[model samples]
Target: MQYIRNFCIIAHIDHGKSTLADRLLERTQTIHSRDRKNQLLDDMELERERGITIKSHAIQMEYKYKGVSYILNLIDTPGHVDFSYEVSRSIYACEGALLVVDAVKSIQAQTVSNLFLAIDRNLTIIPILNKIDLPVANKEKVTYEIMYLIGCTSEEVIYSSAKEGRGIDKILEAIICKIHPPKGNLKAPLQALIFDSFYNTFRGVEAYFKVINGQIRKGDKIKFMSSGKMYTAEEIGNLRLKHISKSIIRSGDVGYIISGIKDTLSIKVGDSFTSVNRPAKAIIAGFKKVNPMVFAGLYPEKTEDYDNLRVSIEKLHLNDASLTFFPESSIFLGSGFRCGFLGMLHLEIIQERLEREYGISVITTIPNVSYKVFLKCSPTDIFLVDNPSDMPDIFNIERLEEPYIKASIITQVNYVGAIMSLCIKKRGMIKNQYYLMPQRVELIFEMPLSEIIFNFYDRLKTISKGYASFDYSPLDYRFSDIVLVKILINHQLVDALSTLEHRSNAFYIGKKMCKKLQKIIPRQQFDISIQATIENKIIARETIKAVRKDVTAKCYGGDISRKRKLLLKQKKGKKKCSLLVK
Candidate 1:
């Protein structure tokens, strides 16, 4: 009999998705005392350090309550704005979702988005109000708000204190009783959804899937519909619910299969499985390609570390398929690679891993968001760019289109006046506002993503005194005044750190960033002038103020070689560094 319940845990940042998973694993005894670790499903060191789920993870557990064994497959997804696309993919793989809401903070920006995705998938939703032990948990208000927003009956909600391991059994029972199980053929042509996969050094490639229709087992030749590639399954095993003996997985069971395949290019997320003899068409229509939102130039500081960087990138690509890289060269930095990522967090994670895991020091240029430019012509053209150097020559651009985002701000009504001023300063237009509660309002705005590129969220929180919450998504590409602020030291342009900004704060931000870079540049043994120039005219300028005492006036001849060599080596060493600190 195939009795399986598939679901994902979705919540806002710091709302206890990972912590809930830990409690479930402990209650179910999936990990033995010796094998246990904190946030077991997170698995990545970076994810643990950041206290955020960067990549989605899946694990199966079996619960036997009153002699009824229920198999549960849970996927933990990223809750941040940058990982929204990945969250969508994770939602698609399951038929139900455990919508976790903090009892105190209640509904949030991502809470709405994740609920919508679950509804779109037509999945059975089980809302769990968590963290009731907290002093601020307002059960009545949060419960009422959830019912109104998600349209779930108040009786359908379940309350739990996942921290104290309370009410976990009831949550599990609700899943088995309410969530629907899969009903598909076991002997029919094979069809499975490849939700996740990883490269194993010993086993080659291991893929996990939920069989929708058909029976698959060891030694059966399988084909990936999207890539049109063939491989034979060497082994098949289900996830041990309580660290017990491995059992054979059937239809609707979440299990892992190992094959001789080694590369990730062959099998991709959203790909389907089929028998080699009777193949089924892949469901490649709705799976949108992961687009890189930010681009930056990444290079090893030491020219000799080039090989190490390449290896690091390849290893990173094993877990992150969205990352892309290409060979690039610059007159100032020589040969390097330009890499693309989903967002800032994705970029930072990769850079940190390269340094910590691979022991390679890298020089990264400023990150840039994509922009589309249209020229006046019979046929309009579109360009996707990451570097300001690639922006259309100002003279040729008739209309420029940059990505705009629909942002929502939630704050106490009393601070609405202050937040409005900050928005105006950033050139954001007010869309609308609604009363979310007695004293809270959700303010809407249509702002350029570029406007909020630099510490916009932090500033919003500061203005509201940590009472503001933000959520934004891409609205559309609209025409805007896109200007590049070029930084020049002593009248020489620095291509490495040039940035595109709204013309409103151009002068102030440019001057501040330039001053920051100049401070870090170590007073070049000579007087240096810093300037921010656009076109041929300067918008901001500052002087380094000549260093009067760099040389040792009392040094003897014997120590000249050591000191000269030291200075020469220092100059050669930090060569990748440029600009003063602001």
Candidate 2:
């Protein structure tokens, strides 16, 4: 245990965390040079295409320095805020972290967020400045920023170019010297913390855990602290980019246990595991339950694929504990499931996986944040609504509270004015602002989660010329004057088009929605009216004119009485059609 080192890499998206991990693996010869690939830790194709890590991966490595053999366990984590919960779990399982920052772009929002998480866990941090080989790299400025953020001296920071495999040996030496090994009691009863898990067809649920006390071996009976169910360990192994069987995983070691349990729900991330026969007196302190922040309804494009969609979602949830879903039905879109996600990126990734991996195309409604509604008659009577279609009648509600978030944006100085203006339009209240350096600034705001769910990120990228990065955390719900805006097509309500917006911007939002709908809905035999309404009042209206055919053109040489009679018949038919629409 004294020669074992457990550490994880944390940084912002596109900051080269995976590249650094690959270099370390190469330096340690854990993976052969002939089988090298870009972003080896990011196994998913979507992750490579998007240039970001989605899932956390752990690998065990053997390194020899100064004729001393050591065991190094490294975990590579996602850098996006949507997967911060996953990063937190990875951090809790490690003894230290490597803080990677870009030499050109300096520190980003997620970089700061991850640093805070590492500090909160009381883990040792090793700061590394990457991408120093770039032509535009600003090493001095970036080193200063890292020093300011982490309170470290210039000599303490390591410089490297991960793409070119520079300074990898120095990083390995630092890890061996700086990072402390895991320490636990070997005489106590068995206790382990399950950080992650995935399903396997051949064996069952494979649980990735760190032994906190005692030891685990094959044929040992273990019980989950939360589920209170017992299962025999079919296998015990360590990860070397692949599962390698081991006879025993002693205390202060990380390994996987193949418990002969078919149900994936029985094994949860952040659950504790202990010996069934000689149980530990107390379970290890695990992380809090993960709660999804964004909600949306996913419907199959074809009704016959409903069962396929359900199966696909179940398979997805087995690997991802942050995702939640339940059965939901819509009058316009048919039967579907109401799904919850960590954020917008999580929702997009799930949708893409369902289509690509499961071969099931789906239609997704507008995404929304959960809202708390209080009844007028009883102040204590409160309920949560995840879908606008399930919202209560407008007349029965007393007050509405929506979720808010504390957002941090880091960008160049020139784009500060534009970002501030955009935040004001989105009803964001500025909380603080300071200069990270003379050329860069950090702006903090408290805004509604619903406001940024649709187009805030895209607009921020556009206005900032793709140099700005953002991170946010959920704040408590606050009472606001919010209303549900409904869209009507020829006097019939379309529940899929409904949205919740602040009362002050109802007119502007409604007008824009009506104009957009007018262009999408096709013309019919009768004039179709698109109306945006709040309660009983219509705020915006657009009319799609009926298809006009010249009936009088065919009767050019006819009598005047004949033409008049034909025109009278057409007018009567038009009046009847209009009455039917009303």
Which lDDT values do the candidates have, in the order given? 0.78, 0.90
TM-score for each candidate, following the candidate numbering = 0.88, 0.94
Tens digit per residue, CA lDDT, model 2, 439-505: 9999999999988887899999999998999999888999999899999988999998898888998
User: Candidate 1 residues 1-582, lDDT tens each?
Assistant: 346888888888888888888888787777777776667888778888888998888888878867877788888888887777667877766778889998987778777777788899888888999999989899999898888787888888888897887778878888788888876777767788776676777877677777777778678888888777889877887755332223345667677778888675677767887889777655535665777767889988988888778867765665666788887766566667889886777788889978887899899987877788776662367776668867666777776778888888878889999999998777789999998788778889998777776678789889898777787777888877778888887677777768877676678878897788778876754457788876567888778864454344445557678678766655544342333421
By summed lDDT, which 10 consecutive residues of candidate 1 come out lowest? 573-582
List ranges where model 1 is wrong by over 4 Å.
Answer: 34-37, 240-248, 376-379, 549-582
TM-score, candidate 1, is 0.88
- Name the runs in model 2 displaced over 4 angstroms: 549-556, 560-582
Q: Supply candidate 1's per-residue lDDT for 408.
A: 83
Q: How many angstroms is residue 114 displaced in model 2 relative to the true structure, after the best TM-score fit?
A: 0.6
